[model samples]
Target chain A: MQIAKVRGTVVSTHKTRSLTGTKLLLLQFMDAQGQPLPKYEVAGDLVGAGVNEWVLVSRGSAARIDDGMEHRPLDALVVGIIDTVTVENNRLYSKKDAERG
Target chain B: MQIAKVRGTVVSTHKTRSLTGTKLLLLQFMDAQGQPLPKYEVAGDLVGAGVNEWVLVSRGSAARIDDGMEHRPLDALVVGIIDTVTVENNRLYSKKDAERG
Candidate 1:
């Protein structure tokens, strides 16, 4: 799993049948230091995360482990909405601070 | 799931039990134009791919779908050795050319 920031939503009508009714979110990957990387991924949003919220993403086939996601062509899935990130006991990111900012 | 070039091998004796006797390879991904990306990944080699070979990679849980690989923690697997890559009716890369170069 990797920490990513939800950038926005992706609405595609003409998608694979398995993706029907699945909400997709645009995500920007964050590095260990909590800094955003140049890489981006469009992931199925199972957690209903909002824009700018930090999320934990499960990539690849594991993304399909959730209920009703089996056999989907999804490569990425938002597994959790992150509250905070601590690295080496240092508070790298806090949702409260981000919400205030 | 993606196109990658096998750069070299990864020899790790101390690994998880499921990875015992598995051959690991260093792979660099290629963009749509067949240009090498800076990103890299260590993938399990199931097809006996060689160094500098262009190969098709299956990533995530799909990688473990192969026989004897079920329930393994593997995230990437070299699925096929590529002979060439075509883009817009033009050959973007060829294993034969790469070998000569």
Candidate 2:
């Protein structure tokens, strides 16, 4: 999983039946220090993550294997919402600090 | 794209209608040198990538927008197959070197 910020949401009205109730969000991958990484990617929303929310994004088939989400057309999902983050060895990073730096 | 090895394959028969022709693979995220990262994650297959092939996986909504794929249940997809990787600033990492280290 990678730390990311919900940048926006994607709305698809006409989609597969299995995707009827799924949510798609634009996620910007962040480094350990909370800085947006060079890569631009997004994740489908499963946990109701909204814009600006810090989330843990999972990619690939595992992203679809979330509990009760088997065999869905999902490739990425917001698997978890981060409440707090703690990094050892002085590696602690935060979105706030990242914005300032 | 991150350097990764195709670990395995996922077979799902009962699936959404839009996903009828899509392929799913088991992917393990790898670091610069091709070693699996600490996180255990997998990406769905889209580029006809096979097991043991190095691929470039995309996550989230972008994973859904590949060429003819739209509004499917895909969250992660192999968008590209890597031929070679070169990192600057002495940061060039490969799967072979990562395995050795």
Give me the candidate number with maximum lDDT: 1
The residue-level lDDT of candidate 2 at B37 comes to 67
First chain TM-score, candidate 2 = 0.79
- Provide the lDDT at B3 for model 2: 44
Expressed as tens digits, the lDDT of each residue in B1-101 for candidate 2 is 34456778777789888878777777777654335765544566655666766665666664665455676777667655554444322333333454466
Stretches off by above 4 angstroms in model 2 are: A89-101, B1-101
Location of the lowest summed lDDT over 10 successive residues in candidate 2 chain A: A9-18
DockQ class, candidate 2: incorrect
Candidate 2 lDDT over A1-101, as tens digits, reads 88887665434343344555655565668787778774534456778876676888877666767666664555667888776678775646555654466
lDDT measured at residue A70 in model 2 versus the true structure, 0 to 100: 63
Error at A26, model 1, angstroms:
0.8
How many pairs of residues collide in each model?
0, 15
Where is the poorest 10-residue window by lDDT in model 1 chain B? B82-91
Give the candidate number with the greatest DockQ.
1
Tens digit of per-residue lDDT, candidate 1, span A1-101: 99988765444343334446877666778999888896666677888998789999988877889888775546678999998898889899999999999
Segments of candidate 1 deviating more than 4 angstroms: B1-101
